[model samples]
Target: MVRNRELLSSGNAAFAGLASSFSELSETLDRLASVADDRTAARAAGLKARLEEFSAKITFVGQVKAGKSALTNILAATPGLLPSDVNPWTSVVTTVAINTKAPADVEGPTNTKARFTFFSRDEWDNLVVGGGRLGELAERSGAQEELADIQRQVQAMRDATKARLGRHFELLLGQNHSYGYVDPELVERYVCLGDDVTPGEGNPQTGRFADITKSAELFLDIPEYDVSLTLCDTPGVNDTFMMREQITLRSLRGSELCVVVLSAHQALSTVDMALMRIISNLENRQIILFVNRVDELQDPAGQIDEIRSGILATLKKFNIASDVGIVFGSAKWGEAALMGSYDGLSADSRKALEQFGAMHPELAGRDEWETAWNLSGLPGLLNAVAERVSEGAGKRLLERVRRNARNLTNEARATLMARRSGGAAVTVDFAGHSASSVMQQLAAKYESDVAEVCQQLRDDLMQRMQSAESGFVKRATDSLLEHLERHGESGTWQYDPTGLRVLQRAAYLSFARAMSAKLSKLYEDAARHVEAIYSAVLSEAEGEFRIEAPHAPRVPAPVGLGKTIALDLQSTWWRRWWQKRRGYEAFAKDYAHLIRAEANSITRDLEENQVASVLENARAILREFLKEHQETIRRITQPDADTAEDARKALGVLQAGTDTGAAFGEILRGLDDMAA
Candidate 1:
């Protein structure tokens, strides 16, 4: 394991290297983007966007009510930084990182603040329209008498959505909705609670849209923690809609460490297990299962043991070889203990602790309480995180810097060689083929490859669709029908008409979400395929032309509405609402077919259109790359002194590993002098 201090040193070195490398690369890319044609400039812009700082992204994710917010608060050393409560409150991704305040003297007092991004009107509309599972709601609702209440809730949701959405209620809204930052004191206004917390404040009738905020980035200056650390407080994986899950997954992408906060009382919930499988099974990520709220358990040790055993069994069942580290802790108690003084503790928390101490006489002393707090498992988890981060972060940073530096150097060399040759020099050929022919072949190959890849993606989508239809869809369908069959009451049929419509809408929306999620997965897989193909094409193109260029990372497609397919179910069940449970069953059966068809249509369009577009765009990028600097390459017969000097400096930096930054000479001299 990397020691904390050493890790910090290496991490700093790596960061400095990246900062220097990016400074140069971004400058070059900016110039290229500025001069290039519209298409080329756009592509270059995408590549430039990828040149971000290599911060160790630590993501906290889990099922709803897993104490993640509380844990984030404790880690940030700001109790109210995130609103942690028993209620399932937060619905947006909140990222916390060190804020190096610019022009330090311009600031009054240094304090943490958050910048929030609200959802576009369209995004809010989607969530409001996409209702949840009818079977789940029915199971929870219980008793035929609750049907009236359920309808009322549905009507309330509709009313609230209209009232909050205002102008957007009648039409699909765009992303032009405004967003702003909150003052340090009002951070909670944006992050904590829902839109109901502050009604008529910013976006009127924002209750239905409370879950629509895009993200919140909290910037803080904490002394104990390294400034390089970035903690991502992701939304619950099981938040109301599939889009929310997409947001969470996107945040987790390229994260260095993923901490899944599990509730001790709840343990590995169904959604928690699903989330676990996603991060552990699919991604190459270091994971920590933080079993939170352990204080709620009577036998925390025994409970933790049981939880670990279950987790291990699940991991084995899933064929995951990684041994996930488990940490049991209570964020509430740990935060209090870390604060040292109880003055910051809430009255309820203090009373609860006092009652617990009174109940357990042996643990009455203050030291013992502190010990118990320590035993909450935060200290060990913190140490483990620090060590793991120290071990991995430096290497990650260095690799990024090295890659950028190498790319920049190669590009410079190519430019210099071409410039000296005077647009006539041809050092090499592309695999025995001319550059023009090779470029043409590449375009054709990409087209063919996209078609073939899309076919494979379609097949995969169909297979997954079959599995989901059999698994989640069938289970949800059968369970609801069985419940309805068991509770056959014709007198309650009067209450059924409106209630059944509400339920049918909910059921259709649920099915649509399921299909949408599957489609999202397919899109992601297809994106990966396109990325791989693009990389392979770049390699081939470069090898053929005998030209070296900086290997810019594959630019990802931006998150947009294209990933989702809007569904408006036909009015087959609207007239049959009086038929009660049988009507709901029929509606669901018809709706499933519609959903399956929609899924297929969406996937086909993605396969034919989106996937092809990505490949074509990638091919265009290669073409642009060649066309952009070919003249420079051709013009170089012999290197000028200045050109040679610049190339030499770039090559020297590359040769020296580019990880030493500006202090490399000083360090090297010290080493040499010590040796002498």
Candidate 2:
């Protein structure tokens, strides 16, 4: 075993450096808290808590048989941990938490390392009765035969599951299983789709429980990486049942980075266009396209450039941004390099490795295994991920921590100066009742304003969505007519839904931009109102104390809006629907109505689910901000006896020629240096 030759050393070093800085920042805050006032100490503690709780979440997504699990295993440095040959019917979403604690909701012993959650009763009923999203789509398209087919499949799955688990199936719903240890057999029992043994039988390692499993979470302590990482392996997008597609989309919404694995032989097929649409919906996520199984190519060294070019061209043709990093490699090569099993490689793979080495002469002088590792492209991929982490979440966290620290230190200095002065204690005459009343009025006004804004935005978005739907119906109807004239509708006519997807994307983007701008302005206005109130009340005080306004909270963009509609599905039901509708004029007219109804459902989902949620969260955040600042005002205007005594003690310590002021100044300077 090559223990020291870890492929993730570079990325691990980057994360370790950032973790060290975070630790230092936390320690500095602790030191400041010991000698600071109550409010400053609380602020420092909050900053430290945020530092400790930060983690980067990355999700791996791709179609079925795209080598996602294989690539995930190689990246996490735990080869063979996940089964690479998952069946298409498997719907489990596996998450690997590296150097991070299990989620708070997970209940288990301290030694528990794996948790498998089953679907709730409601969720199972939805899949069975509602037929998931595919049934909805089929009904909207008036494809009765297709809808029945979907329901039949669902019923068959339910019956098979009941037979396998007997009466324990219902008992397992809404429950989770935890294990103190994990192995391949343990993982396969919950994640794989094989059905050799029954669940209620004496065989405990059967995959019969896999169908009802919702998620699998594995916690591992990998010492190579110093920071926390959550790697989620979502089910493939091309499942026949389409349940995994919904699961995958939900996973994407929670992730900050996405690694899209593609089979090198069929890099980007038409079926993968849904994946493209999903990627396009990610607002500020970092995406890397990894073309796996390149070792299967006859001449990887000679074919890599052409493959890269073709993939880039496809992206450009689709109007996607060109900055998405693309890397070509084979996970098998990485596994071999990790285990130092060069002798086990086939002759052709060995020859290809040699050729890869010759292509990059810089590695000729290094060990052959090292060269093979580089040829795997895992090193490059890791470096790219590290770079993104450093520039994205890591940078933002460091900035926020430094800003809060400086502000707290400045406030502490102001408090000290006020205490040291021999002047009478400054006090504002604003009563607590009056402050509460004023805040209530402001909160009511904010609520009213937000409601009005959301209503208007909703109306505008609905109009746009309707228009897009009408245009798509017209175009699709015309296409259907053309197909009828050409082939008399005897055979199936399959039309691309890319146009509808594009229009829907435009509407979604418009909604995102408008909501973001309006809500951000509202947040700023609310902050200013509170600040103005503070300024007015504090002006009545007699001292020259300086109090900075609270920092404005960042408004999050509307989420859960990237839902993949049924129209984007490339299932056979679409063609079957067309074939069932043989007449031309009636087919076009009925199809148009069905499409219009689907559009209505889509619009309603956006308004009620996505838009409504955003507005509610925004209001809650605004309310919290106002409430905190109100408390702050009350604390400053009416300091308790304990706080006054603490201030006096701090002032006396300062009077004894303590270097507290100089220390604060040094901390400020350090913050400035970090900002630079």
| Residue 551 of model 2, lDDT score | 31
Model-by-model lDDT, in order?
0.49, 0.73
Over 152-194, each residue of candidate 2 has an lDDT whose tens digit, in order, gives 9999989988987999999999999998888778898899866
Highest lDDT model number:
2
Q: lDDT tens digits, residues 212-254, model 1? A: 3567776666654443567888767664334455666567555
**Would you give me the overall lDDT of model 2?**
0.73
What candidate 1 gets wrong by more than 4 Å, as runs, is 1-52, 86-90, 99-113, 129-185, 194-212, 223-229, 235-257, 269-281, 284-286, 298-303, 314-322, 343-376, 379-401, 411-676
Error of 1 at 61 (Å): 2.5
